[model samples]
Target chain A: MQATPALTVEHLTKRFGGRVAVDDVSFTVAAGEVFGFLGPNGAGKTTTVRMLGTLISPTSGSAIVAGLPLSPANGVAIRQQIAVMPEAPGLYLRLTVTENLEFFAGLYRIRDRARIPAALEAVGLQGRATDLCGNLSKGLRQRVALARALLNDPAVLFLDEPTSGLDPVASREVHGLIDGLRERGVTVFLTTHRLEEAERLCDRVAILNTTLRTIGRTDDLRDRLFRKRLLVETRAPLTDPGSVFDGSPGVTGWEANGSGVYEIVVTDAKLAAPDVARALVAAGADVLSLAEQRHSLEDVYLELISEDVEATR
Target chain B: MSGERIRAVVQKELRDFRRNRFLVGTMAVLPLVFLVSPMITLLQIPASTPVSVIHHAVGGSSLLLFVVPAVIPPIMAAYSVIGERDQGTLEPFLTTPIEREELLLAKAIAVFLPSVTVAYGIYFAFALTIRFAAAHAVSAAVWHTPQIVAQLVFTPLIATWAVWVGIAMSVRARDVRVAQQLATLASLPAIGITALITFRVVTPSVRLAVALAVVLLVIDIRAWRFVSKLFDRERLITGSRAKPS
Candidate 1:
């Protein structure tokens, strides 16, 4: 049986006057999964997150966040169920880290005061709780925002550019914290422009450009939008690389570049690699290396965004 | 509205305000000067002047008391929403479960308490200076007249009016400086009305105080409603590019 999705957005749209910022975008994020929302600037990624976080009302369509319907009527309940770490850390600079967390705890009406210290500990800021937020580094301020979000123990967490502007070590620390949240079964809706971060952390990703151009498991998208290819390097140039790939069950096409290299399109590179190597050896060619050429998420993202831009133009 | 949420915002704002030395200095210094300067001038009045004229001069001094609440709250409240927006804290704050009413009321109360406290403090201090420093001429009866009634009753109403106006300006203005300037401009009418009473252009009477109080009370209700509407989540989040006319 399929578990009820943590969030389901159906044709969610937002318009600013005559301009439609988010145009009929739809997707679902299952419980405990990290769903990355990737888009360029002006692609309405922040607008969509604002709508889901109940900070702004959608101009049209509907959504269910953590099983609660998205509407002004359910806004308070929905807010209680979800927490958003906005693009800016947005901490109260004058207040201490502990004061900031405690203030939010009061807003969330968290009965147990112990949760403040626990949240601080969870974000690895136990020692800095008494330090003023303005005095902290940018990375530490981001972690303080994260700690504030967790005060509510929200069922769904929306992290927008969570690792943005952080040093490498700080970014890695945040990634590990997000990993811990996943292990604890908290659903995460991550919006980031960082393709590599999405590729590393997201179970599924949606590429949005005002509208959703594509949405699926990252690996599934890589496979569907890109071709799987095998590259072969040999000791000597092959006379007829087409003959070796021809009539092979999994091989779709083949091309021989000058020198000692050939590239072949395959349905599954893992299954077709051995066959291609065997064929080359039988044809009196010494194969030095055979490697699969997998497409990165960045390649898929750029291709989709450019295609959408061209189509719109 | 949840009291807990309102209290939370209020406490946090107060904590933040305490750390803002410039704001604290303005709130403190202005009221002290406004209250004490008049007292010094009134004390220097010649003893040869008629008792009725001294009485009138002391009555006019009560008008300076109105400035305490009027000036302080607008300065503090003007910074309430627009300042938070400039600091980037307003977005995260709006995302919380707290309602709009709770957040605005919290900010209003944060300014209201300090403004009223400082205003009343100056009032009593002014009264003491008259009692001890000018013991020969100015009688306590001057402090017990209709002007005193107006000061006691109408100061908070005007302060509340200033706060609501400041909050309204803060919601509409894009920046803190703009909010402060607009709030100060909006407050001119209240100060003008008080000035009329101070200069004897409009005499203070029980009926007049009650009438002004009633009018200000109605304006307060409307201002509160206007502020509540202006703080719509969509407008605030979008920076209100298309401001309501």
Candidate 2:
């Protein structure tokens, strides 16, 4: 893909009367990037998506999505390049799945009537196409909605909490579908409360609280904020092998279980682990097992949110 | 603006209307009852009265003429618009290529056309009743160029007004039930007029009714324009405060 950002927000601001939802927020999403927008609810994630999708106009700033300006007149053009899946399933419940597809196909200005059949097949709704939308299960309805969003073969896809209320199986199906989209070079902007979703799907993430808190590669962001903690299990415990080099570096905290195992939390591991082993040997404790606990993405996410909340207060 | 697109939209609406057999039944029953009830009532009128009762019933026909077209069309149009909305607004055409305006307009027509058909059927039935009443009892029906003009010209204008009301309410209201209630509420003026005619509280004058029709025509044009503004898609999906201007 090219180097240019597929989506750009310049000095973006959205104010709802007295309160500002998105305040001077600016970010860029690179071409074909799975850009994750992680924010607590009511952090203007949905607002920003609506503006970028051209559903709502921005209060002050401007956004260029798929190389098209976001304006009502340019709605069709912008919409042609991006598909938006709102928080709810905005569908025609009365129409059968086939009829619903036919309707949206016309809306997208797709003339070939036959593509409708293929589109239904793409979502694995070929059999249910004849069924009324109201009769379908919530998971099935969400699939139909995703199918409609894909009608135009858009370059950018906006999914607003795509799996928020779905069962695990359905959520996995959706995640798999999104993963396939990444392979197909489609840029995805997703707003999700599930931090794991952002961790798994996003190449880069921007944590938004009141404004853009921080934006970067997920691993980089996590490392920049919190030190990596690892969980390791050794075959046997270390029995007082320390005092060989008591002041060793990178290892701050160490504890041992009574069995042939030891639990270790290290900060400066270069000096600490070696000396701790020697000290354990001198103390006559057998080095049977060792283990380190690894910090998770959730740990980083919670840390960031807490930091932001603290800063706001 | 595309013919193909417009045709597609119209077809979707027709599909909805066809599926709503309850609405179809109401359209048939209302028109048939209104048309046949007056004739049946007239047939029972004393046969001993002069056959010239045809001329006398002209007054009744004039009153019925205004009442039938003015009252029924608006309420019927409203009901139809609201009825389609019953399936949760999104449940119907969110996926359709048709613009919201075109969809609303087409639905308005769906509501209007059936209403006019029922009203016209009532008029035709009344006319037939007048013929039968005159030959068998009193020649109460008055045949005049003006009466035909009233039915052909003014009745259509009235139907258009009703369609506008239904469309306006349909777009403004969130669901079918609310739209139907609001549309039904809109016909209060016609109902008030009908009550006046029945009570003889207001004189049965054709000129006043025609004047009301003229005023309604102007308001109808303005309402149509205003209604389209409500279909502001941005405000519909995004909260109104979302847009800058």
Candidate 3:
């Protein structure tokens, strides 16, 4: 059976003055998938995210979020099904955190006030429910925003720069909260400049610099950057380790150090690791640290964005 | 508007209004200083009015009447959209299932309720003072007219107009203070008319009052329709069009 899409954006276009913020962007996010949007500053990620959350309407394109059309005509309906945590803190500072939750839960029409405690618990803010939102630390404020979004038990979540200004520990807490949303089958659409964040949370990502430069699974991007290379070490010296692999396949970029430690770049290390191991044994070298090394998502992210500038230039 | 949706929206708006002690107190204070302070002086005039005393009293009274309707609403107008925008509650409130009007309805109530109520309260206190001034000496019809109007019809209508103009200013201006200034100016024309009438330039009569109220009502109708259009959630959020690079 085919999976249903949680979001469908087609030819999404938004203009600010004569500048195109988001131009002809089209993509579909499947239900329960964590879709990451990576971009440089001013790359229109927030604009796109805002449009999806129904906080703002598009100039001339269509979006279907949670199977409802996203437009001024149907904004209320679309908003009912989606949770949006904008980059900035959005809450009532005067009201205590619990009051803020109760106010929103009331808007969402949750009859009993008891449910607010549960919502607060989810964000680990139950203990601080009575504290004023304004006086809380930045991370606590972020969680309050998150808890407010989750009040409606939305079908899709749009979190824009959720961990942008957080300390490392706070960032981890927020990251964990976001990761926890997956268990409820909420479709999460996120935007971040941090490549590691995208790698850790997103199932797939699109690198956007003014427009999409490249998009795919993280490993697929890794492959485009470097060949599959594994490290193997042996005794002090080995002469011509590759001399045994006369019939081995796909070792195009071959380089082996003279310390009986060999490294051969292969397209697929699974097939090549065993062949290289057999050859190393034949060469009387004991195998050690036979681990595969891969390129980090950060390297791939930079490589993709810079390539766009180069191509445009 | 669906009943549940309206309630949901109203409950939230009222909740926010209740949460805002500063706005409530500020709304109450602006009118006290502007309207009640003047009304107290008007009630101080003797019933056996000296020619000079009546002239100054009547002139100031009419100006207060004009401003009572025009000026206070504009002040109230600042509280409409600017408060919501400044508070960062605009998007969340605007996106709810509640119809825009329901939200505005509550906001209208929020602005008008305090302005009109305080005006009436001041009128009530001023009325007792006027009655004391009359019983202690003499009473005149005009001396009590402003409070009666403030109580019966003029205050409510003025509050409505104030809220209407306020909604527009709040939507159009970038911030609450600016909106407050702009919306407060909505009463200028009323003040001008009162000035013309006060100088024996034009007599204040039933016909004049009705005509002026009719014109105001008509302008307010157009303003009502126009202000709702400005209440667009999209514009309030990203602001006006962005400059393209």
Predictions' DockQ, in order: 0.56, 0.33, 0.38
Interface RMSD of each: 3.5, 3.7, 4.2
lDDT of 2 by residue, A254-283 (tens): 444454444555664444556556555566
lDDT of 3 by residue, B161-197 (tens): 7778788888878878888887777646545644654
User: In candidate 2, what are the lDDT values of residues B1-245, reduced to their tens digit?
Assistant: 45555566666666666666676676666566556655655656666766445445554544555455555555545544444435434422432334556656665565566566667677776766667564454333334544554565556666676677766676556666566567655754543443443333565356755765677678667866777777654455543534464
- Give the candidate order by descending lDDT: 1, 3, 2
Q: List the lowest-lDDT window of 10 residues for candidate 2 chain B.
A: B88-97
| lDDT (10s digit) by residue, model 1, range B111-228 | 9988888898888888877777774666453465776777777788888999999998888788888888889778767866666655567776888878878988898878887889
Clashing residue pair totals per candidate (backbone < 3 A):
0, 60, 6
TM-score of each: 0.95, 0.80, 0.87
Q: Which pairs of residues have clashing backbones in candidate 1? A: none
Write down the worst ten-residue block by lDDT for model 2 chain A. A237-246
For model 3, the superposed segments whose C-alpha errors exceed 4 Å read: A109-114, A233-237, A244-250, A256-263, A286-288, B2-25, B35-40, B50-59, B62-73, B133-139, B142-147, B191-218, B242-245
Model 1 vs. true fold: TM = 0.95
How close to the true structure is residue A285 of candidate 3, measured as C-alpha lDDT? 75
